[model samples]
Target: MEFDMVAAALRQDAADVATYARVLTVTLADVLPPGSVTVEYERSLGDRLKGREGHPSRIVVRLGERTLSLTGGHRPVAEVHHEVRGVVLSRDQVSLDVWVQALARELVAQAEADARAAEALRRLVTGA
Candidate 1:
């Protein structure tokens, strides 16, 4: 599914589009097959010493020949990088809304063909 499709679904299902998109990104990362999505954490020395798992700072999703990379902090802005095959297509600073929407769209597209992904999305949207 494209971002537009995901947006339409969210408009119909979610009370808050931005929050749902962010949650969907995390859900996709957790549920997708290993090696399909990679998450990076920004752990401080104190966190490492305490054996605490830091929050995700970066997520990279690879679908077929395209890759979408999102890097974010505590702010509502994120750095997004997209590549097709091995060529860089776009790299820009986008709002958190834009970032999560892109990620959700990729997950929706994956769900269209993958049962596991579809199940995850269904469960998420229905809260079942």
Candidate 2:
């Protein structure tokens, strides 16, 4: 079958981005086919306030046929590692510049895979 996959990231507050990343990861997995999407998150510590410190966060997403990953980090200092995956025709990404770049690359890879799948399907259908 021919498939099309698109991935994108939206700049938003650290907390909101984290929340949405997690929620979307689960939702996408449930809705999409098996093993098609991935989500990740990275969280870091923030500045010290009255001896209390905060953190910065980022998010990432991957949407494809065989692999999907998303990562996000949380606010003052940021550390990223968390990741998840699912299946769907939709897209996913991390709002951070670095993660977004990586996700973009993965999207291209997925597109290639989708194209190959399409070509194979066509060949099968035509018996050629």
Candidate 3:
């Protein structure tokens, strides 16, 4: 988890969104509990034609039965899926900036309470 890199990518306008998404997924997967997050990879048509390896294309984070997913690309948006009663509900087109800020805040809160999380976050912010 390159914590400093993730923060830089999120802040810099010229940063690659795909790379940001990938790094974010990796860091969250490390800090969060196991099996809570998953990532999918795919090659674009051009990449496939050129025989390049697939890149991370989707990331999903599950909290109980509800899930939040984001697509990795030039412009990323978040979608939330959950069930109520017997019906499945979905909220689409959530702003990526808002979603990330919420996650960042949650991570900070967790860091404040847990020594391990604090260390992970410390590494993330300081790149140590």
TM-score of each: 0.65, 0.30, 0.62
lDDT of 2 by residue, 1-128 (tens): 32222223222212355454543344223333344443333323433433432321333333433232333323322222334443344444333444434533444454355665444333433445
Off by over 4 Å in 3: 1-17, 44-53, 63-66, 80-92
Cα miss at 88, model 3 (Å)?
A: 5.6
lDDT of 3 at 79: 70
lDDT (CA) per prediction:
0.61, 0.37, 0.60
lDDT of 1 at 126: 61
Mind sharing the TM-score for model 1? 0.65
Candidate 1, 83: how far from true, in Å? 1.7
Q: Model 1: runs farther than 4 Å from truth?
A: 1-26, 29-31
**In candidate 1, what are the lDDT values of residues 73-127, reduced to their tens digit?**
4453455666777787877777656655765676677787787777777766665
Candidate 1 worst ten-residue window by lDDT: 12-21
lDDT of 1: 0.61
The global Cα lDDT (0 to 1) of model 3 is 0.60
